[model samples]
Target: MNRHRFSTEEISIFRRSLLAWYDIHKRKLPWRDWHDIDTNIVAYRVLVSELMLQQTQVATVIRYYETWMKQWPNIKSLAEASEDDILKCWAGIIIDSIFYWSYFFHLGLGYYNRARNLYKCAQLIINEYNGEFPNELETMINRLPGVGRYTAGAVSSIAFNQANPILDGNVIRVLSRMRCIGSDLKKKSTTDFLWSLATDVVCPERPGDFNQSLMELGATVCTPQKPKCNECPVQNQCLAYQQQKEIESILDIEQCSANCSFCLKSSDVDTNRSLVEHYPRKKSKTKQREETSFILIIYRLTPKLEFLMIKQKQSNLLSGLWSFLEISSSKNHLDQMNEQKRKTYIIEEIQQMPTIDTIPSINNIKLAGQCRHLFSHIDKQYIIYYTHCEQNDVLIPSTSMQWFNEEQVQTSAISTAMKKVFNVALPQIKLKTSNGKKNGTIDNYFKKKNSKV
Candidate 1:
């Protein structure tokens, strides 16, 4: 019945001794270079790594990071690349995409495009701060786009050799095991306690090395699983070790997951239990839904054979994106002529707009290929329909409507669903205007109506 706890004085000694151990045994990583901090390369690396590490492992990021760096070394290069190309770089990491991580790619792109903002922060360092990375954590944290307090401390101490304490999951684990902290690390009180302990233990002069050393020790020696107590530099001073005869024997007293407070399987009674194998069961799948969509591709040749693109603003899901007019239905009964009860449905759906009653001025209509896009919350099955319109009289221009050439459309931040739409519609457009093929159907109708008037 031995409890592991350390006094404030002993914690300071642990910090200094662990830092000395880190001086001898720290592993070299790509982002640790002294000269790279001032450049965007390190910033980009840190951003991408942080993004990639969300719900993913460090071992998985190595090859992907290397390949991405080799292909697009800088932010400008990444911005110039296609979404498909970026997705290729993110080939293996798709399974790791939870809600927050799904937005990582977007955040990365946002920051990359806004590199001038980053330079605003970086240039000030070279010019005003004299090429030295900022030592004060809060100042550096305020400049970056997405960096929070913990991340700021990590970068400041590790990159700038500042006297800042890092309180990541690894450090929390070390402190929790040493003190036998029963509270969950996610709780605010637990976090505050751990941060205070981390501050108490950090060696001031080489705080960066000291912090990294603690993390490195937790990652390698004081691991969540069978910790190599013999290899630990400060094993003699550790309260957990001094109370119990040996690390292995102490760990054996409880389940493997119970000893490590950060273990995913940790519970209130016994925190450490090897539940890694059982984690997949938490995410069980149910029956998938079937959905259908009708996408309209209307074309007018006034501005170099451009198609009508609508900016969907009604819903936040597809808001402000240039897409075709779309309708989602439960069944594929679009071709069935609606002579009865169709008007009521149309009136209800298009409550504000009454212009949809007169066949919608659709010219020659062609059925394009179907596409399927799967989302976490919803499933979509798209059937594309293209209509050719060489006549200018019927074309309407509003804030939502845009006519862009193929080159212009290609460079935009279009969704993957729209990309699939373009793949099928482009060839259909070429077919309509292959040999002076005009939109005669709609033109003839307009001419006849004008004669009647």
Candidate 2:
């Protein structure tokens, strides 16, 4: 592979072509609005856009971004808003596969924490910087919660007009193909090299446009599968193109560290293909860990139907969010328990609850269908159970427990996992109610039973 650096003339040509192409083809995104160039406004817009775009598609973020800007136009406003409101705004923006991507970055830290950090970050900026977003790279990184190298660089360069480098997935793809970087993109060495190259090529005069152009090029022309090589502005300077043309002659072979399937060059004609297709190789990703848990959808009728939900402690995962009563087991424990054992375990755990004695007989508990929730690193299987009792038999609400009707549950600060569980239980409840039995009748019967007792 050609590892030579671009000449000064070549670099200028690449920049000129890229910028010209971007001028005509650049996506007119809400955050990229050039009408409001005020530094403070620009910084806030860039920061919010960056956070929203994490593992999210541009189309998906546009609506959310516009809505968010309308609702919380400034950092102070966002800081003043409750966490539940912010999270509810963030709900649908996270697409299915992208959730996994976010999970990978956050690992132990759930995506809800991102919302929490964004809140804290806004508060910090308001308190320390007097509500003005910091322009300096180090200041932004040090002050903002969850603001790392990429986010800091992006905000500094795009909003503040500072000459900084950014290396998001799109930028990485563009760089890897441009230089024919065969090393695993996940390696620290490869990342450092790419950052250095990005810094080197960034236009000093218009660093924001330069960086954004590279990213836009990757997003539009140089896509991962079936790249538009003919339409790429920087194709003339791309070493991958040159390598693809000459791969037929170079006999000496080296195994690709990325283990990519596309660029395998062999002496056999059948195996020979363009090496350009595999320029930006990547190591295989680890499989998602599978886990099993039991979610209890307990309800009570006291003239009105209310479902049981638990508020997660502020310190654990999904902190501050409410979810259904769940008995979760790690993969190891799941392996130890057979299907029957798992069912029994769930029942025993529910029976052991302090408030269990207050509820009527558990004989009527019905096993609802299972639900599958995919996180970044975990594939969770949730077995749902539905049960209800008379209002007088229901336990009193505690700090961590609450009873909510359907509408309340819809608006409550509930996790997506719990929402899935609710979705599963809703149909079951609807089916039961659809058959002759009326909610009002059930409620009156339970109320009369309580009064008589």
Candidate 3:
């Protein structure tokens, strides 16, 4: 799987130009060097940020990263933290950022496995590595849970200045266009070839700066839609840009090799998009599966205003996060069931809750609200149903299933779906105190709802 060898002269020029651009243009990310002299701390920081930034956008990841570092700060702190703590920290905690509390955009950050994996990695670092992060890739870094080649490469090169290669989405776009690769990117052959190219061109001496530069170049300049070719520092090195300039003649294109099978042919050019955009052939997206579920907010009004919340046992979807009792069903099944049947189903589901010592008779079940939430591969419809216990009944609490008052619900680390449900459901709770009077002003409830972290 050898790529066309890049000469030392060409590699040197690429490295120099790319690094210069990065120094001037790289985004001021929080996980970047914090003037920390210890390379271990720097490596730990990079690993955490990479894990968080995997499925979420940078804007969303920034606040979470800041909150995480502030709480854990180091490898030992993260390892010492409980699984619940890790999950809660991984979920959005905005007590610190009161400035954004009024209008914080709540992104699900759903892949709960990433958070669990982060916790596992931290424990491994402590128990196995004596609280020190393993610097070498093969030594222990890549072996860490949820760490792949790309993440390992990033940590190694960026933190230890190791001569490793990284190929993220941005870098893939940049390299595919640079080499004018037009094959199906979803295919293994194209991916392997791109990895080979990435390995070949990585700067040996300043690998850290070089990798960051390439990523920055792709992120800011060589963007997917309309690449700023005129402003690209390495436009001279990009074959697709040269192709777009009508320098397709083999002699004129400096980067083009002699009839290479790896490069896109002239016939591959898409008229709809320019030549550079054509290189990285866009992969067709798979349609998201439709999911329909009933999120039952089983509550009580006797002792105080409290709602029952069940901790999710499923790891694949919102794993270990707290939400109301959920009953999943097919859309057709849900449609066929009438309102009375749905309540019967809810009653039956409540009876089966593992921790319930006594299944309280539901007083009045009503449709509070409904909302749609999108996961990575599922479009979920939440039919929010809320009900309370009879006048003399109360819900017994357990480790997995606990009760939360309004203030606690506002502060707890519930799933984003549950939070969305609360936005609609809680206001209609008829917030009555034990003495059967309106607890607080409705305006305060609205204010508290708006400030949910």
> Over 4 Å off in model 1, which ranges?
1-9, 33-48, 71-88, 95-136, 140-143, 246-453
Per residue, candidate 2 scores C-alpha lDDT tens digits across 160-202 of 8888999988888888778766666667877888888788788
Q: Any runs in candidate 3 off by more than 4 Å, and if so which?
A: 1-5, 93-110, 247-260, 265-268, 285-453
Q: Count clashing pairs, candidate 3.
A: 0
TM-score of each: 0.44, 0.57, 0.56
What's the CA RMSD for each of the models? 20.4, 20.6, 21.7
Report the C-alpha lDDT of model 1 over 214-236, residue by residue, as the tens digit.
88887888776667777888876
Q: Tell me the tens digit of each residue's lDDT in model 3 across 37-140.
A: 58888888888888877766677778899889998999899989889988777655332333234324433443567888888888998999898888888875
Specify the highest-TM-score model's number. Answer: 2
Local distance difference test scores for all models? 0.60, 0.76, 0.77
- Ranked by lDDT from best down, the candidates are 3, 2, 1
RMSD of 2: 20.6
Steric clashes per prediction: 7, 0, 0
Please give the TM-score that candidate 1 achieves against the real structure: 0.44
Instruction: Tell me the lDDT of model 3 at 363.
Output: 44
